[model samples]
Target: MAEVHRVEEKTFEFEVPVVIVGAGAAGLVAALAAREAGADVLVIERDSVPRGSTALSAGLIPAPGTRFQKAAGIEDSPGLFARDILAKAHDEPDGDQVALVTREIGPAIEWLADNHGLAFSVIDDFTYPGHSARRMHGLPQRSGEELIDALRQAAEAAGIEILCDAHVTDLWADATGRVLGLGLVRPDGSTDEVGCGELILACNGYGGNKALVAEHVPSLSDALYFGHEGNQGDAILWGEALGAASRHLGGHQGHGSVAHPAGILISWATVTEGGFQVNLNGERFSNEAKGYSEQAAEVLRQPEGLAYTVFDERIAGIVRQFEDFRRAEAMGIILTADTPEALAERMNVPSGMLAETFAEVSRLKAEGARDGFGRDFSGVADLAAPYHAVRVTGALFHTQGGLVVDDAARVLTRDGAVLPNLYATGGAACGVSGKDASGYLSGNGLLTAVALGRLAGQAAGRRVAIPASA
Candidate 1:
């Protein structure tokens, strides 16, 4: 931990209706929502450039029964979404949190699109793992950068001031535990205090902290971390100091197919469309249908933590619309060949074994058989001529747990009591996923981020008693 300057006795320099720490998706959304609900807002970010774990994501947000889904003629509901989460996160802590997210996701997304001018549409082409319907709503580019850019634009237009390079050092509170203001250290080592009636912590989790990872997620201690370096568990530490309760500290989101040298994410859509992963021995190890996060542990256990995603031209074409996949292809990370043998030769694997693997996949698809690894090839197509492969490895994207909060996004103590005037969202709050990498359903990160952010901002706005014009 680096030394952070905290002055216990100093006059606060500024005051706002709501002060948001960490200008990622959660902070930006909270600012927008708070301002919309008639509150003055300020967002302080650690990085000079505001790219957090949210910007590294695929920008997919799952919201069942949204107007976009209805326009696309897809039948879904929050009940179904909650059921899917419970099914995946069985026996995991904070199941109610999952239910709260499911219930509010639709409205949260709709509010952003309708009121904040955010552009989002239903991903009607294919469904992600654990989602019975195509409920993913994303920007046109399907990139988190685009989403963040849009949110920043909206925040700026709404008069939300985002101060970058403002690293928050501590929260100023009285003996009653009611947060009064925040302490910050500027990049030049200058310290300042900013007062606020309410505070929202959106700084995210501790994936970049090696000590926290080794303590909570020991299984992935050796895996590569691909999330933002700014997520240093400040929210968790601050919450702990405030006597806040925590939940699901072991849960995380993992990526199974990060391109080895290029470090680009290979979209899971390719795997769902027909692609498969094979180890260096030219042998399929686990079920590709298990989804990216769930398959990450399996990929980590592979020989030297290396695997190849083998697909055909058809699957590539189907998934090329994704910005990351297209970027990978443009970077020459995707290898192409006319035959399985040629592809295997290009991958430096035995041609006979690779051919045998493809033959087995085709035979199983033809006979409608279950694979030895419990993979079902029901909807996948047989690989045709002109194959494609990308060398990839597993990586830890972000932690999924932090300060436990109520449905209103107010921070809670171990005894289930709310901490006055303090709230948490995004990775700062406990996630809906279970206490493992496998419990992460697609888009759960952004779902909680945007939804709880909105809830927190609205609650703060109403509680602050600020004028509508402020």
Candidate 2:
């Protein structure tokens, strides 16, 4: 755990109006927001280059009522988006939080594109499991690497200063959790203390921490961590130390579609678009359509902790627009065959059993019935030759739990009291994904990151501006 300094009477090297920790989407967005609101902001990143969980993601964000949706003539609203989030999470999250993110996310992303020049386009072709509409927006490639790079470039262009390779190890504050300054340690063991009138924690969750993973999400304790290594629970731990409230520490985003051994993220589109998963026994284990996050545990429970995503050529054409899918195609990691038996042979699974699984799928589609696992295959088109498949395994993408925050993104105490001069955003704050991976709707992570991040920055900026005026 990072130490919390009592700061009875401390001196600082320098000061900034607003200080943002972590240079990922959340931090950069917060910096940009604060800067836009007429506040001087400083962003501190542990890594030399800014690539947190945002970089590892598909870079998609779910936002309704945006111009993109309007241009596409897709009728949508924040209420619909909020409803989808609750439906996916089984209404386990705070309804107000859901409403807050849903309401603000559209404007947040729109501000980014209009002001920061992010080339966002709505993904309307195929829908994610829980989303009710085609509201996902992303850059041209739809890659997180591009998203983060674009944000970094945007921040640089905005004249916001970013301190790289500076790992925050301590929070200097009073007992009230009113953060005053932070201690940063460089890779070369150098230290600096910088004071701030307001602080926003955008450092994200604890997915990279093995002990935390074991303590909370024990089922995925041994699962592959696909998020940024910098997600070490710094915000959660420090927030706890500062008497801030934390919730649903076990909640996380887990994906069952990571390409096995090759370390590539296979998009869930393959499964959502009439594809299915089969274990090494070449049998369908669970309904693959039950959301990819929950499918992680399902995949891990299978033999050898591995599963294969089986789809068709048409599905491949639909998914090729994604950068990761194209990379997998270029690497020739996706196996294809003219028939089920031939594909089973290529996948080294039992041909008879694989054929049986295919037959079952066909039966369900033909009968328009639900499977034993509750997956409905009636609406989707039937799979045809040539067949395509990719061997995959489950992995932890990021934890969806941390300190609780309010509408203004102010960090709160266990008693529901706000902590002054402090805010948490992104994975640093409790997410809307209920209490487990199953609750994760696609793009939930980025929704809060960009939405809550902007809100926090604006509130912090207003707070600072008010006092200066006074």
Candidate 3:
């Protein structure tokens, strides 16, 4: 057995059935489920505030076969959802894992709604790319902050203790790879120890860590990272130290239409609702329908790493239901014009070229012609009068890769052996989006977070009793 280091300082030590790191979507949901399964759970967060990348998201979760989908008269199944994911991630490394998440996502959402009293409604206005069914669900406010708030409320009501500003510096595990507990650095510069029967790493990914970005996802190293700074990859480091295998290290989610200077998301609904991105030359460079994550690289390659999202009043109206778009509009970030020429002038692009681009889009829609950039305009209508535009740039939202795990959310070793008493979910675990940004189907992040989190929590809760030291 490896020698265990003992802390001599007069601080504090506590024991629980499960000790979770990070207080984001994953940790909170895990705590709820574990407590439901009769385990004593505690959550530790590095930040004083609990918000992480999940709060910065649109809070969309894709769950097929949900009660909301059935009530909306949409026929769907986990098999169909798995097919959509596999089709998008054409050579996905872990098809079984993708299928596992798909199977559990619906029940996870139902559990949140029924057991926890969290409310969600389907996003029926527009369908996100790569999903055959309209199954994206969100809070009434359609914001991640709202979802996090709901989860936090549910956790608190369940008596789950969440300690913020407590940074976990180390995991104490025996030589057999059984996690014993964690070392925490308190806000007052004091050190403490927490002993638990199980540990769940939910601290998110390494998108904010420049060195990790360069090492695993070099192509996106230069792009602006919009994820929370707290996602410094503590889970990856600790998992690796315990010989946990990692997968899909290059996979990430990127947003292509973050409003430049204004620093707010323009909502992909603009592009999905017949809007298009143009470079400084006022030319369409790529298919706008490829989805935000896939089109991020193309947007980054534009001149000065900037582009403009051009849409019409019809498109704007269709997307304005989203709070992010509404917020952007209220902030006066969305520029409006009566003609393509005026819009181009407002955007500082070539007026004639912009007009020509608009004409081409109209011609394609009229003649049923395939776009030169490989976009299918059959489903999209031409832009009418009263144009809208938002100057935009691409950004890495979060990394989708981390510790490898099985269907139970149990972290695994390089040789495919399970790490006893340790689990991971959310950005700390490998996602189902293959190994790059292009394979990220919408809502994969939160789906994995909630589904795997619930599974990990239940599994941990049922296995061990609270330590007598508590």
Q: Which candidate ranks first by TM-score, i.e. highest? A: 2
Q: After TM-score superposition, what is the CA distance of residue 15 in candidate 2 from its true location, in Å?
A: 1.0
Q: What is the lDDT of candidate 3?
A: 0.88
**Estimated TM-score for each candidate:** 0.96, 0.99, 0.96
Question: Candidate 3: deviation at residue 164, Å?
Answer: 0.4
For model 3, residues 306-404, the per-residue Cα lDDT tens digits are 999999999888777678888998898899999999999999999999999999988888887788778888867778889999999899999998899
> In angstroms, what RMSD does candidate 2 have relative to the true structure?
1.0
Q: For every candidate structure, what is the RMSD over all alpha carbons to the true structure, in angstroms? A: 2.3, 1.0, 3.0
lDDT of each: 0.88, 0.93, 0.88
Ordering by lDDT: 2, 3, 1
Local distance difference test, candidate 2: 0.93
Query: Quick one: ranking by TM-score, best first?
Result: 2, 1, 3
Say which prediction, candidate 1 or candidate 2, comes out ahead on lDDT: 2
lDDT of 2 at 209: 90
